[model samples]
Target: MGCSHLVIQRDFAAFFLHFFYQSWMLYPENESTIVSWIWIGIGILFLTTAFIILLVTHYFEQIRKNKRKMIQLVRNAETECWESIHYLQERDRERLSEELHDNIISQLNIIRLNINTRNGKELNSDLKRSMQLVRELSHNLTPPDLNGIELSDFISDYLVQISKEVEVLYVNHTEQDILISGTIKLNLFRIVQELITNILKHAFATEITVLLRVSVKYLSLVVKDNGRGFPMEKYNKGIGMKNIQSRSRKINAVYKFKTKPEKGTRCIVFLTLNNTKI
Candidate 1:
């Protein structure tokens, strides 16, 4: 009975050893496969995280670049405004000096000469003409009282005066009164005057069309002429054109000139009324 018990115990021991060896052999392959899969998952997660970070960084960089461009554009516009103001001021000074020298001073000198001659009739005539000239100059320098007058009416009267020299057409598109400062009106009038003067002096044009449009948010003035158009390059080099551009900047208006040889010239000015100085 002792021998039979020993044989049974040995057999049980061998079966247990065989089962343990098989389990160990299978464990190595399964463990290796699981480890490889875990590593691959970790690598994929790391790559995805890195890609997300890169995308976020690029988006912020693009935003920063756009902001910088906007800032630069604003700075450039401000610089142009200041330069235009300075140029217009200087031009005005020069104009005043010319008017004094050519009109007032010269007329005074002529009156003085006539007085010394003691010709009553001629002196009377000269004095009257000189007075009239002075009045006109004063009117030119001073802004007319616009308390009861519409801007369109004023412009219409002005066009009528010029119509004798050239065919003039004026059109008004807005019924409501344009609410703007007196200074702005005066500047705009001066700009129109300058343009007309240029057309008369250089364009040799017989017909001119002026259009004025006022809306809730903006005002537009357009001057078109059927004349011998000058080259834009030549126009830019002239002081008169520069003066026009300067005035436009002073009013914070956008000015565009379209011209070609023998075709015609068109000048368009756009002024924003909303939240603007005008």
Candidate 2:
């Protein structure tokens, strides 16, 4: 009877151990519900990621379109500014030329004729001298040299004459002679003349230097002054600067500046030049 009891006890112990092992390995409490929730969370994360990527791509496209629009607006504005400035300068030069030639010169000749007709005792020597000076001044104001001489030589001589009134130092660095068409030379000469006038009137500079250099690729000009320089941010958008910019563009050149208060100013221009002439 004691042996039979021992066998029954062993069988009961083995049955309980197998039941615990199966419960731990095959099934946890509420496993089906937990797995369904995990799959839903993963699907939400994937959708959020895709949406973010789409939004970023759309933002980049908008930025590129805005950049292109901005560039186009700038180009249009520049072109309009050029047209307006060119028109005004041409009109001004034409009117001034006419006034000098037709009105002032005619008046001077009339006075000279009257003096000649009056003859002897009525006219004083001082009066005749004054009339002569007037004629000379008029001629100087409307110089006839623009149409005749080569522009490079003309500019050199012109600068030399201006130097008597204000100090000017210049260098010419082109290897071969430059012979520009009349229209281009006239426009360039007027631009240079304006710059010189400004330097004399406002720069208050003791020294001024101009350099003209040419290479196969480009022709370059530099004008520098040791004087009080203006703020480019304020001055470059002004009417005078606009005029200069238009003229430079007409010549297919680039203009830039370097300046500082109490230090000095430098103006630079670069233009395409043929290899044969440089």
Candidate 3:
């Protein structure tokens, strides 16, 4: 009986040990599955973070590229402006030479001939005309006084003088007084003179309209004619057009030209007054 009891007790102890071993193996399998899921979650989070960083970096790169392009464009425009100014100066020198040779020198030669021929009667008249011509030319070259006179008054006087030949209509659309720098005023005067001269020389227009608009922020000048317009492609190649462009750049103003065949020509110059010398 004692031996049988001892064997039964040993069997029961073995059965308990086997059950505990099986439980330990089952627990390890379940823990391994949980660990694998946690590892996958960590990998997905890392990938998502990397993607967001890449997107942000790409956006900033695009912004930097655009900024560089804008800076380059501004530099190019400034260089072109300086080149235009140089060309204009050269053209003016040529004009001065021509004026001296054709007008002043020619007139002096005639006077010398008259004196050599002993034509005293006509000499006085010729001398007076030549002096008057010289005075007129000098006045046109010199800059006008803007201290006492307003810009509108100066332009009005100019228009009155030119009104005799062509029907000119002047319109000033500003309630308050307009003020501008002497340099700006002079350039503006020259631009207007050039435009009118161009119209007289080329445009067979019956009437011309000059409009001046002023505001707190900007000033605009519009010159339009009712005549046959020339081709824009050809006209842009002319010296007069180049002169206009150079003057506009000198003033740091915006220039626009509108024209079509038989539709007449319109030139508009816009100047911003904010933080500008004008």
What are the Cα lDDT values of the candidates?
0.71, 0.64, 0.71
Looking at candidate 3, the ten consecutive residues that score lowest on lDDT are 97-106
Q: What is the C-alpha lDDT profile of model 1 across 21-67, one tens digit per residue?
A: 57557786676665665566557556655665676678788999999
Encode model 2's per-residue lDDT on 125-201: one tens digit a residue. 43564466457555644434455666667669667645644578888886555555565565566556656555655
Candidate 1 global Cα RMSD = 17.1
Cα distance off (Å), candidate 1, residue 6: 99
lDDT by residue (tens digit), candidate 3, 1-278: 33454565456556645654565567766666656645664575556556656766787898999999999999999999999999999877755544444345445554663465546666787688678757856765443357776677777876764565578999998547556767666567667766776666577787989999877678899999988888889888876666677667878999888987788899999998764334
RMSD of each: 17.1, 19.6, 17.3
| Deviation (Å) of 178 in candidate 2 | 3.8
> Residue 5 error for model 2, in Å?
99
Model 1: residues with Cα > 4 Å off, grouped in runs? 1-142, 275-278
Model 2 alpha-carbon drift over 4 Å, by segment: 1-148, 275-278
lDDT of candidate 2 vs native?
0.64
